[model samples]
Target: MAFEEAKIRFKGSISPVITPFEEDESIDFKLFKRLIDWHIESGSHGISVTGTSGEPSSLTIEERELVMETAMKTVDGRVPFLPGTGSVNHRETLRLTKAAQEMGADGAMVIVPYYNKPNQQALYNHFKTVAKSVDIPIILYNIPGRTAVNLEVDTIARLAEDCPNIIGIKESNKDFEHVNRVLLKCGRDFNLYSGIELLCYPMLAIGGAGHISATANVAPRQVAEIYNAWAEGDVTRAQHMHFAMMPLNDVLFRDTNPAPVKAALGMMGKIKPVLRKPMELPSKEIQQEIRETLMQYALVL
Candidate 1:
């Protein structure tokens, strides 16, 4: 599909799948492929790997590239394959993004430079350089809580104006006003995805594209249903799914990211609850909470 046509199709629940690991802390390619196929079968509009949920920062460049290759190969153009290719290092970001383009990925999600706290101009330069380098669509990831820096709305609009391929953004911040401002400034056609799970329905309600959420890892059908409901003009059903998903969303983030999500996946017997170093399984208390929440949704018995 042409990039233009693909942008329209990208406006739905895109699952940022967790990178499953073995007990030895190696990437579980077997489990990873299974998760991708499951997401597609479960109704995820698209599949993303190596995002925050996938623990991109923990994996090496080679490992990240391998994950992207695996996702693209598994997806096989069944649904859009968007891989998170950003890093704190610009060179590494460019390398992975270039690889994504060459590997036939539909688009790439590049995160804001974390820890360094680059100013708005520096952020612009970073994205502009990458967008210029790659031919595929670019989705800027703005998670101030994790990155310690916000991609200001003006800077976002500027990037959209300056780089045509810098087409969309994943607004992970809690501030809904940022979502409004991006749409107002960048135009309604600019694909704005809500990375915050709770904001998914609201984002779609406001002329935004869709969500690239971690919660979708456990509830892909529900999450995709929310978007499908809204698209079909069933506001009532959409709202129901939105609120129904709240508890699961909360539990998934009870700890730091994919830990809770990975745990839930294990409980469902989809994959083993394993994470790389510095990211162990969720605590016993949180694991129980996750189980209770999933039971409420009947995801686990």
Candidate 2:
């Protein structure tokens, strides 16, 4: 299928879903399926997984594929499912992206090559190759904080011009000017999304498609409402939701991601507070802080 012919339009609060794990450090498909349903039920606009929040590094390739298959089955086209299919290795990124395309994903979110810190020209070549390999829309994931390299606006604009399937980006970058420049260079129709929680509304204000915020993992409806409200022409409500989410956005990142997020979910009885080795839960002080933050929204659990 050509990118134009594909029916799904990636937008709104596409949750970078956390992979639920059993207490024994196994993938918890049952809980995973339920979590997908919960995000849908909670009015998240789309579902995405195997991204940073999903702990993609911890899972084997086979485990990632199984999770993707289960997500496809469970989502059942109710909302778009975009899977993170990128890796540091070029071949691995290609293989996983092809796998996602085969699994009926609405699109693939490919991160910039990390660790190796490829040059802009190399980044362009790598993404163009990946885009050519799959017909699905390829949204570039530019998270310099974790990746240790920035996907410069010029490079991204070049890819947008060169690869039709290479669409917009999910920027976790803190530089507001850089993001603004992306929209200016890539044109407003480019499907830019904010991966940073605090910038979700600000991004929308400047023509962002939507967000894939980690905050959505704990507060889906409120998070989605920021976009929905803005789309509905209620700037006041959208601004309100944005500020409402600020404390949550702050608390969830008191520690590393998914730890506080998964811990928050666990406290709400959504999933086990289990993480694979080397990724521990939030400290007791942080957990208590997370608990108090959730209470502000009346999430007493």
Candidate 3:
């Protein structure tokens, strides 16, 4: 699809889902399928596999393909499927984006190039080039903390203006000012999905489309509920729900992303808290804290 066409087709709350592994520490397709079913059943608008939360860095190309294939087959058109296609190198990124489109993914979440920290012109050209390379819509993922370089508002506005395929951004910076600026600079065609879970309600109030949240991995229904209620103008209900989730969100990141999320999932008896090497399980103390919070929220065993 053309950029203009893709823009119209993509927008909403999507989770950067966790990849589950069996006791042998391989991608566990059964538990993976169950996790997918849980997300869709809990009303997640879409799932972005092989993302940060999915430990894309740890996954090989074949492993990524397995997760994407399983997610597409499981969701099966019930919800949009978005897979992470960001890499530091352009050629690799294009290969993945094209792969995502070929595998019947609805869209691709392309994060800003990390490590090398390209200048503004390079950033613009990078996204434009990859976006032009594929038929699918491309949502820019700009979480500077992870990537090091931030996508500038002016450049982002320009990208949205020039590249019709560059539809939206997941602003994970946790800076509401930045989110507001993006909303102001780009207007409605350029959707801004909150990358940070805690800011979803506030972001929505300022015209953000929704979230690409990590917290959704543990409490899909609770996080999705805030968006649903806020959209319907139920501010009181939304605020209550948002407040209730702060501790849960904090716990998910107490270790570092998917570790805490995977640990929490294990505690819930949903999946084993298995992560790839170099990323260990959260400490027992952290696990206790997560359990206590889950108890407080009444979300545990």
Candidate 4:
């Protein structure tokens, strides 16, 4: 779809899918494809690969590109495919984003440069350069907890004004005011997606486009339904779904990110629970918590 069409269709629960790996830490393309199809079958509005939940930092550029390729090919226009193509290194970010554009991805989620801690001006230049380089829609990802530098509202507004393709932001910060300012300054047309699970419903209530959630990796139906309920004018049902997902969302982050989420997927027989180096499986206690939580939700036996 064209950027104009994609901007409208990119709303709702877009799963930042976990990158399934084999026992020896090899990318499991076969299982990865299955997960893509499963997300679609389970009502995910879109699929996002290689984001935080997908372990982008661990994967090589080639691996990240391959995951994007697999995701696009498997999705095959069934729904929008947005692959995370950001990195601490601008060159790598450009390379991955260029690949996504070439492969026909609907949009690209470029993260704020991590660890380097660029100031507002530097951040502006970094995003502006990338946005100029790509013809596809660029969704800025601001997770200061991970990236160590917040993409300030003014900086975001500047990019929105300067780069038409720099269309949206995935605000993962806990502060709702930041999200408000971005939308306020950038205008309602600039897409905003909640990266925080608990804030997903609230974000939508405040005019966010949708969410790109890790919890959706295991509960695609519930995540998607939150948006569906709200959109269908069932505020009561939407609120209920949001609260119902609280326990599961807590467990998914009991440990660091994809570890807990991947383990949950493994327990549900969706994929192997292997993780790359420096990112191990969740602890036994955490695993027990996950199992009990899933069981409580009837996500497992």
Candidate 5:
């Protein structure tokens, strides 16, 4: 399918799923596949792999390939698999982008360059180069908090205007103003997803497409329900769900993300909470707190 079509079709509650690790801290293929199946079965509209939540930086190329391959195989064309193919440079991003396209991913989530911040032109060129290099659709990821270089509204507009494959974005900064700016500036075809779940209703209020959420990794139903409810015009139900999830959302991200998410998943028997090197697991106190949050939500038995 065309990038724009894919973006328009699956524009809601896609999870940047956590990569499951074994006790040895290796990728657990079995658990990973199960998670993918579970997400699909649980009603999440789409899925993203190798994102920040997926611990992309810590994964080896081979490991990255493994996760991508497993996700593609498990999803088996059931839903859109928008894997994060971002890297610090164009070549690396191209390599991963090409791999994802070849593996039957519906599209690639290309993040802004990190560590080596690039100018606006460079940023434009970086994404342009990748879009030109790949046939699959490109979903721009603007999580400036992690990358330290925001893909500004103008830059995003430029890319979306210039690059056909650059169709959508995952906006994580939770800045509703910026989100609205993108929605206002970009054409109706442009799909702007809220990477921050807290901004889902606000984003939807501003004509934003949907959300790429971390909470969905644990509460897929609740997360997806918020979108469905809102779309169905049940704003009250949607708002209630979002407010109900806020406390867990705050604690799930109390530390570096995915850590708390993985920790929460561990409590739920989803996976081991062992993050890769340089990414520590959440503290016991924090874990207990997450567990309490889960219990309160009745996500735990």
Candidate 6:
């Protein structure tokens, strides 16, 4: 697809797919592709991998590229592949992002440099440089909760103004006022996406293009239905889906993401809930909560 077409299509419930691992810690490419196919067949709007949900930090650079390559081939252009290609290291971020572009991804989502804590000006330069490195559409990822530093609204506006390819952002922030300001400053057409599950509907209500929600990994159809219902002008149906998903959303985040999410998938017999070392499975309490919630959703018997 052309850049404009891909940018326009890069909306709705884009599932940030998880990277399934075997008990021996090898990447389960087969199960991973199955999950991607499941998301598409179940009506998810798009597919993404190697973001927070996919445990990109755990994968080697080559592995991330392989995942991106595998995902695009599996998708076969049915949906846009918007993979996270950012790392704290600038060179690695550029390299992976360029790789994603070469692999024909619809867009590349690059997170703010974490741990290093660069100021706003530094943030602008970082994003501008990455956006220029390749012609692929760039979606800025701002998750202040994990990254320690927020990509202030001014910096976001600056990047949007400076880089034509820097088209959108995935805001995982909880501050309502801040997000509102982002729309006003960056312009309503700025393809804003809510990375936070609770704010998905609210973000769309304010003219957001869509979301990169992790919850979509478990409840793909329901999540996409929220966007589909709203897009079809059924506000009531969209709101119902929003509320219906609240319970599942809460339980999934009962522990740090991906953990609870991965465990839930394991219970559904999708893949083993194995995480890399230092990032273990959710606690037993969290697991029980996930199990019960999955039952409530009828995702598992």
Per-residue CA lDDT of model 1 for 1-301, tens digit only, reads: 5656767988899999989988888999999999999999999999999989999999999999999999999999999888999999999999999999999999999999899999999999999999999889999999999999999999999999999888799999899988899999999899999999999999999997899999999989999999999999999999999998898888899999989999999999998899888888888999999999999999999
Candidate scoring better on lDDT of 5 and 6: 6
Q: What global local distance difference test value does model 6 have?
A: 0.92
Instruction: Provide TM-scores for the models.
Output: 0.98, 0.97, 0.95, 0.98, 0.97, 0.98
lDDT of candidate 5 over 33-141, digit per residue (tens): 8898888889899988999899988998778888898888888888888999998867778899999989889999988988888988899888998999878888999
TM-score of 6: 0.98
List model 2 lDDT by residue over 1-301, tens digit each: 5565432367788988999999899999999999999999999998989999999889998898899889989999998888999889899899999999887888899998889999899998999999999888989999999999999999999999998987779999999999999999998888889999999999999999899999888988899999999999999999999998899899999998989999999999999989997999988999999999999987654
Collision count of model 5: 0
Q: Which ten residues in a row have the lowest lDDT in candidate 5?
A: 2-11
**Ten consecutive residues with minimal summed lDDT in candidate 3?**
3-12
Q: Give the least accurate 10-residue stretch of model 1, judged by summed lDDT.
A: 1-10
Model 4 stretches with alpha carbons more than 4 Å out: none
RMSD value for candidate 2: 1.3
Residue 147 of candidate 6: its Cα lDDT? 90
Candidate 2 lDDT (Cα, 0 to 1): 0.91
* Better model by lDDT: candidate 1 vs candidate 2: 1
The segments of candidate 6 whose C-alpha lies over 4 angstroms from its true place after superposition are 1-4
Candidate 4 lDDT over residue span 1-301, tens digit each: 5656767988989999999999999999999999999999999999999999999999999989988999899999999888999999999998999999999888899999999999999999999999899899999999999998899999999999999888799999899989998999999988999999999999999899999999999999999999999989999999999999999999999999989998999999999999998999999999999999999999999
Candidate 3 lDDT over 217-296, as tens digits, reads: 98888888888888789999989988888888888788888898898888899998899999989999998998988888
Q: RMSD in angstroms, all models?
A: 0.8, 1.3, 1.6, 0.9, 1.1, 0.9
Off by over 4 Å in 5: none
